[model samples]
Target: MQIYKVGGAVRDRLLERPISEVDWVVVGASAEELLAQGFRPVGADFPVFLHPKTGEEYALARTERKSGRGYGGFTFHASPEVTLEEDLLRRDLTINAMAEDAGGRLIDPCQGQRDLQEKWLRHVSPAFAEDPLRVLRVARFAARYAPLGFRIAPETLALMRQLAESGELQALTAERSWKEISRALMEPRPDVFIRTLHDCGALRELLPEVDALFGVPQPAAHHPEIDTGEHVLAVLRQCAEHAQPLAVRWACLLHDLGKGMTPAEEWPRHIAHERKGLKPIRAVNTRCKAPRDCQELALLVGEYHSHGHRALELRPSTLLELLQCFDVYRRPQRFEEFIAACEMDARGRLGLEQRDYPQAGYLRGAAAAVRAVTVQPLLERGLEGAALGEALKRERLRALETYKAEALGEPSDPPETPRP
Candidate 1:
């Protein structure tokens, strides 16, 4: 009997990350053998156990059958005869198809190490298309390794599109779908999440709202670029590359979604695009089963007209309005994130270098203004209590007024209290 480390744990080991989860494939263990060994038994479809000491999961090496429909409909065979190589061969990707014996001998019959060294993601077997979940998993892997310049196997991508068009992808369970998507969305290039899905045709099947963005026209001046999808990709690239929180980055990626299906009638110099853009996103979010929180975040992005540029003549009420949105954004550094995303969207506009006026000056001025209003001074003067906060607010207002004409917002007023 052999117990081998498998799957993500091996991948994490190679990536030099701490292993949080461990799966031991007990090659010759039956349910009775596992139970005798003090591993807590669990599984109808696959034989699995919890290690008695470490409490880590330990699943038996097994074969499977597509007994039903969708991703979950699998019948497993956990016999003593099934080989470890056979089990590994049936997996989705080469990077995930290696096994490690207890003595730490890694068995990579699939050349996974070569693929990992080349930074390429490839399916383990041609049977990869048997399960629909592999489509989403590949998209996720693209996001995982995009920063490292990895590319999927062209043939693998073609097979994915073939399966997606076959309509098998719809069989994926919501739980698994959400898990893969949330992980991908949290990746360094979530655009890869969307792009790979789109290129392979699963995007329309899973999330038509984003797919509808393809080829949608935008206002000529604001976007000299081709379509809404292209612009969104540019901005999302910036969002993914930035240090903003996941939710804020997601907001930026989805911000302009409203404009895709909505009609635009421009009046010479103004279009009220933000307001016009909101309705479609709201409708699409509600209709497409988008979570309420994601919908609200999307609105937060599309509703803001200011681009974190020029403080030109922003008044107290304008600043207050921005802060109100910040307050509802549900994070400690929401304003910073929002401002970062807004600047990304604005500076990413087509022909940024061809601006009518200097864009950098405008961006710096806008950031200062947004920051001044949303992030009040940490303290006030004259004793403690709520009075300190009042003083800080008063000082911030004064600073804002005094520095209104400056290229940037006012410098932060010092804390009113600091004894030596």
Candidate 2:
């Protein structure tokens, strides 16, 4: 059997990128022969094995036929007769369809190298439309390679639009859809992913809540971009520019959902939008089956991002409540992510990308000051049970008050006397 390196390993190698994993396509091999040679079977739907020594995946050269719908509706045919060119033809993109032999000779039956050299992301064949998942994959590749001056070929984008209009996207499972979305959000230009999907009409099918924001108006004074959709895209760009984590980027994307629900009569004003956003945030979280951390942070940012923006102006009690809601003492990292999302929102407005966001530092300081209030002191004072809980609350409040006063350069309020 002849084994050849294929897919992303070959593509990234050609682009001089850091290769993370290697996959192999074993042509002229049968399942029985691989099992006899010590490769461990791993694939459930097709013939894929793990190398006994290297543990990397080795899939038999195969061809696929579209049998049903969505991502899983496919029948595979793998045998000793399957050619390397036949296997490559079933791939999604031309760049990803090329392979390399054991001797490092490039195989280019699909003209992938030519497309790569021209900085074009073109489809290998019309079979690209068979799998709905390719729409997300192509958009993700756009996000990854856009920095290198790559653009999707117009014909490929037309196929993506066709897929979006075919009602096939609705059949994608939440888990599969979220996998592509979360990965795309972490790419260097995640905004390009969303924009590409929007251009192809997939955004409305897959993320209608976000799609609704496109034409919504916002106050031009606060959001110089004026369009809620553009503002969200700008926020995503900011998150990518700073290399923010996935949770922060996810929160930033959904933080402004309520703006889309605003009445046109309200025009640029969206009063109480922070509270209004909670429903759509939960809807999106449920639909995407987002991880617990990502969903929790998105909900928090959506419901209270305005509070974060108004950090310096909030009452001491309000600030303390906000900190408690975030469970800052137990999950300080999540609190930091929440603030990062808020900062991105504040900076996303047109002509204000570099403006300072003091709210993040202010909130961090408040969390630190409150966390410094120890239960040990109350325990030393003979406090126990409900009294201890009340004492701890009062202490934390007093600490927050002091911190706020200090941060704002104002006189501190006198601590309240404890009840007997």
Candidate 3:
């Protein structure tokens, strides 16, 4: 039997990057042979075994053909007769189709080496056009390789655009779409790749809620984009502009997604958009396989202005009371992300005045500043765990008492005593 390393392990090794996992394809080997060699057997679709020692996956060499549609539509066949070339021919892209033997002899049956050398991401065969999920995969590849200066070939892009326009993208699962998006967001210029998805139409299929936001108008007092969706993406960029956690950044991306579907009457406001925004975003969390609590921080950011606006009229104790409401969200960075969202939301409006772009926390610097003033007292109180949490509720109320009138044009109130 011949053993060859395949997929990401090979790709990472070629790039001189850290290799996290190694996958192998064993040709001319039967399941019994693998078992004899101490590989553990588990084959639901195709023959895949785990190394008895390291538990790494090793699949028997196999070939596939499209049996129907979408990603799960493939049918595989393997025999003692199949060649390695037969297997590589079915890969989605040239760069990923290359394989390396145990001794590191490079196999280039698909011209993948040429594409890798040229920093290109090109499809391996015409079969790439059969699966719409490839559209998302290519976009993710562009994001991963963009910082390294790789580009997709013109013809490959043409095929992707065709797939996108034919509504083939709709067949992709929410889980699959989100996986690519999560990877793309981790890249240096996710917008570069995400914008390409919009042009290709995959964005419309996977994020119709957000797509509907593209041109929706904001009240002239707030956004320049005419829609909350653009504002959210811009804000999402700002959140990731730093080395923030993926959850916070993703929350920022979807902060106002609820506004698209829940249009406000009486001219044009989302009427507590944050609260309304959470229901659909929660649905997204459920449908897209996002963490159940991912929505918590995003909802916190969303509700802040609306809630903060109302919190203004309350005393510090009352404001603290409102702060208690946020305990369910629980992200340490929730307040900071909230301010960042506000800043981006404000700056996104068309014809934003200096007043509109209030010299305060809708942008991160101001948000940080407000956080410092608000958070310092809580930190200084020497509260730990539960005490610290309870203190934060009071501290937030104190800040609301401090900034409410200044920021939201809401009525002001005096501060109140902190809990002992």
Candidate 4:
């Protein structure tokens, strides 16, 4: 049997990128023969094995046929007769269809190298339409290679649009859809992922809440971009620029969804959009089965991000309520994430990209000052049960109030007399 390196390992190597993992395709080998040689069989859909020493995956060269719909509707044929070219033909993109032999000989029956040099994302064959997941994969590749100036071929884009229009995108499961989406959000230009899906009409099917924001208007004074959708993309780009974690990025993407539901009669003004956004945010989170951290952060941002942006102007009590809303004492890191997402929103507008967001630092300082208040002092004073809880809260609020007063260069409130 002849083993050849295939897929992303070969593609990334050709582009001079750092290779993370290697996959091998064993040509002219039957599954039984590999099993006899002490290889561990692992593939449920086809013939895949684990190398006894290296532990890397070794899939037999195989061909696939479309049996039904979505990504699962496929039949595979793997035998000693399957050619390397046949296995390559079943891949999604031309760049991923190339392979390399042990002797360093290049195999490019699909013109992948030429497309790579031209900076194009082209489909390998008509079989590309068989799997709906390829649409998201191509968009993700666009996001990954966009910094290198890659563009999806017009023909391939047309095919993607065709698939989107065919209503096949809904066939993907939530887990599978979220897998592609979350990965795309982590790319350097995640905005391109959403834009590409929207261009192909998949956004409306897969993320209609986000899609609704495209034409919605925002106050030009606050959001120079004016389009809610454009503002969302700008926020996402800022998250990437800051290298924020996935929860922050996801919150940035979904925070403004409520603006789309604003009454057009109130044009350019979404007075309560922060509160209005909670439903759609919850809907998207439930649909995607989002992680607890992501869902909780997104919901909080949806409900109170405006408060974060206006933190310096908030009343001391309001700031205390906000701190409690996020439970900052127990999850300070999540509070930091909330601030990062809010800062992204504040800066993600036309001509405001470089503006300062003092709200983040102000809120962080408030949380720190409150967290410093020890409940042990109140408990030591014989406070108990509800009285103890109330004392602790009052102490935290007093510290936060003094912190806010210092920040504003104002005189602090007189200390409260101890209750009998």
lDDT of 3 by residue, 1-420 (tens): 998999888888888988989988888877778889898887666689999998999988888888876778788887766778887888888888878997889887888877888998889888889898888889878867777889889889888988888777777787887788778777765655666677777677777666766766666444445555556566545544555566666676776775776544533566656666777677666767776556666666555554443332445565444444553235435555554445544433334312233322322332332355454565777768888866766555555555654555532543221100
- Global local distance difference test of model 4: 0.89
Give the distance in Å from residue 24's predicted Cα in candidate 1 to where it truly belongs.
Answer: 2.3
TM-score of 3: 0.74
Q: What is the lDDT for 96 in model 3?
A: 86
- Ranked by lDDT, top first: 2, 4, 1, 3
TM-score of 4: 0.96
What TM-score against the true fold does each predicted structure earn?
A: 0.76, 0.96, 0.74, 0.96
lDDT of 3 at 219: 64
Worst 10 residues of 3 by lDDT: 411-420
Question: CA lDDT of each candidate?
Answer: 0.70, 0.91, 0.67, 0.89
C-alpha positional error of residue 350 in candidate 2 after TM-score superposition, expressed in Å: 1.7
Give the 10-residue window scoring lowest on summed lDDT in candidate 4.
411-420
